[model samples]
Target chain A: GAGVSQTPSNKVTEKGKYVELRCDPISGHTALYWYRQSLGQGPEFLIYFQGTGAADDSGLPNDRFFAVRPEGSVSTLKIQRTERGDSAVYLCASSDIAGAREQYFGPGTRLTVT
Target chain B: AQSVAQPEDQVNVAEGNPLTVKCTYSVSGNPYLFWYVQYPNRGLQFLLKYITGDNLVKGSYGFEAEFNKSQTSFHLKKPSALVSDSALYFCAVRDMLDTGNQFYFGTGTSLTVIP
Candidate 1:
């Protein structure tokens, strides 16, 4: 089976610009999550969606970060007015369900805000 | 808040020797612990998980983890080290009782297997 896939493996943009990262979860995965990983650091949670609705958005750093999982399969992480601090690897993961299932991760989209 | 900690930033072991990467977790309720390995420029790959029942859980590539409730730790261990096993390892924990059920990851430990 195909694992989670993320588009635009690398994206470079200027500060204050907008960028969108896409994720395609594994087949039949009902839960999707987004995380940010800085250099020499672990991945930090961003947002999670159960089905079409976002079950948790608390991990989102600020209002500038938003994510949507419409149609219950594909998800998009949108960053508004990106900052240099936003430069990092954006990871996407998915699980069969929300509980104790292990998440399958994608190659991730590396966003560089110069 | 749920959180996990990898006390060691790096671990080095000779090939064919045993290896251990330590991880501790804090959660309000019973924990769902997991181990993941990441190669350079690649996404995280699941190693193993401990939901309940057995304290020792085996995973891919001859990896295993022991879940300790009293110590609040889930340490990743392997019987023998291989040069191919060198990678960054992350420990994660999820509070089963939490409604959101988001995982908390550790800082990550880089493992280097010296040949």
Candidate 2:
């Protein structure tokens, strides 16, 4: 089975620009999550979606960060007015219907805000 | 707030020698622990998880983790080390009450297996 897939493996943008990162979960995965990993650090939670609705978004750093899963299978993480501090690898993961199930991860998108 | 800790920044073991990577967690409720490995320029790969039941859980690549409730620890171990095992290891924990379904990850530990 195909694991989660993210598009635009690498993206470079100027500060204050906008960028969107896409994620395609497995065929039947109903839960999707987004995380950010900085250099020399572990991944930090960003947002999560259960089905079409975002079940929990408290992990989102600020209002500038937003994510959506309109069709329940594909998700997009959007950043508005990106800052240099936001440079990192954006990871996407998906799991089965059960919340506690193991999550499959994608290669991730490396976003660089110069 | 839930958090995970990896006391060692790096661990080095000779090939064929036993290896251990320590991890501890702090959570408000029961903990769902997980171990993941990441190679350079790659996404995190799931190694194992300890949900419940048996304290000793076995996982992929001849890896295992022991869940110690009394010590609030879930340490990753392997009977023997291989050079290919060198990578970044992460320990994560999810609190039962965390409605967001977010897992808190440790700082990460780099493992190097010398051949």
Q: Residue B6, candidate 2: how far off, in angstroms?
A: 0.5
lDDT by residue (B2-111, candidate 2, tens digit) is 89999999999999999999999999999999999999888899999999899999999999999999999999999999999999999999987777788889999999
Report residue A62 deviation for candidate 1 (angstroms): 1.0
Docking class of 1: high
lDDT score, candidate 2, position A15: 100
* Candidate 1 Cα outliers beyond 4 Å, as residue runs: none
| CA error at residue B75 for candidate 2, angstroms | 0.3
Distance from true location, Cα of B108 in model 2, Å: 0.8
Indicate the residue-level lDDT of B57 in model 2. 99
Q: What DockQ do the predictions score, one after another?
A: 0.87, 0.74
lDDT of 1 at B49: 97
- lDDT scores of the candidates, listed in order: 0.95, 0.93
DockQ of 1: 0.87
**Cα lDDT, model 1, residue B44:** 99
Grade the docking of candidate 2: medium
Worst 10 residues of 1 chain B by lDDT: B96-105
